[model samples]
Target: MSDSTDLPRFPQESSPGPTGPTGPTGPTGAAPTRPGTVNGAFWAFLAATVISIVSGLLVLGERDSLADAVRRSDAKLTAQQIDQAATVAMVAAVVIAVLIALLYLLFAVKLRAGRNWARIVLTVLTALQVLSLLAGSGGSWIGYLSCLAAVIGVVLSFLPESSAYFAAARPVRR
Candidate 1:
């Protein structure tokens, strides 16, 4: 057998040299960067959340009309019952709006983090909103505007740059 000194050694075995640099590395790249489309989507979601809250407030503001309509449809309802029903309806509307706004914010944060699942979920939600807008006729302008904002957010999320960023952010398989 040849002497150990005659054998060629690999670079790693030769020495414990200093590494070039140290930094964080995710499945994606060195660092995450926010694309313009993502920024637009974030703002759109925020606007949609605000619009939903305002719409709920408007519904609350029209409590009298709601109670009158309810009373007209059901003549047997006493004044106290009518008032309770209107208050319950307004409270339910406000709660639902708050929940939806919270969901929008959650999606915005996840999307900003380059989560592909969040993008898909937001897209699906936007589609549902569009369908609801098309099927309903009694929605106020605020509802329509919120739908428009959702559409814009979805559109921006699907832009070419956004797509590329999401692709780059995908988890790398070992």
Candidate 2:
């Protein structure tokens, strides 16, 4: 007679059933959708930057005695100072344009990717732009119109559609 302890045990699968320790179930939800506010803001920012750079370049290209005279009265700069200022302004404009373009691209990517931080960043940036437009006024025809256009752009960007989009993109509480 054989002992019970020597009897066969439960059969196991050849491949070893449940070979590893059990793991908890994964998160039970999908990620949210991207918003359009990011896209619109990105486009507007890029376009504004490009326009500013192009205009600056064109203005710098036209620098002559007329430009010097204009700068002398408008900026209280001497002839030599005007020349220096023009060069500085041109370089600054191009650099700023590139930087703004890069920022816009980053903003768009972050907004689309649902980074959440982009919403606050975009809001602050747009608000700063609005303030700049108001503070940079010079009462000149071109200056006034430029500022007005900026104001309009900023205002339109706050429309319901854009607002909703931005809200949706905001970070969620876990």
Candidate 3:
């Protein structure tokens, strides 16, 4: 026996008949087709990503307001300090947003490929994103639109048909 493996081997022609406890071994099941709901979810996630990028760009126009808010939150800071803080905050925000958007895109592709874990992770991310959007905005139309798309995506991803399709897709491990 090769040192690489010592497991028992079964003859290919020795499949048991239906009299076996697990029934006769037969041909493997084919992969499940991608469902409409998953496609809808994928599109919704893409829409949310686009809306978020637009919203971030629009937010750049409000730098003055951001600085004022930062000053208010810390009265002792000098004007230069306030500006630096605001700039740092904005840069950090953009970086984090970009990372989150990329994550959404990655999971969306994986979910479309019938990865069940991707669906679950995407669902949680969507919930957090929607909650953050709501908590951070008063009535920003862009934020609302993104939230709507994210909610729709998560909803579609968990629907019965999507769930069944995801469940039906099983990965083979080496």
Identify the leading candidate in terms of TM-score: 1
Candidate 3: tens digits of C-alpha lDDT, residues 1-174: 567468787677844322222222223444566778999999998999888888777767778999999988989999999989888878877887788788889999988877889889978887776778768757488888988998899899899888877766643111
Model 2 per-residue lDDT tens digits across residues 1-174: 989999889876343222111111123222334335445555554455455445445555655754566685776667677777767766776677667756755764565454546645655765665576668643344334433443444444566655554444342324
CA lDDT scores, all candidates in order: 0.80, 0.52, 0.78
What residue runs in model 1 are displaced by over 4 Å at the alpha carbon?
1-29, 172-174
CA lDDT for candidate 3:
0.78
TM-score of each: 0.82, 0.51, 0.75
Order of models, best TM-score first: 1, 3, 2
Model 2 poorest 10 in a row by lDDT: 17-26
* Clashes per candidate (backbone, < 3 Å): 0, 0, 0
Ranked by TM-score, the better of candidates 1 and 3 is: 1
Query: Which is the winner by lDDT between candidate 1 and candidate 3?
Result: 1
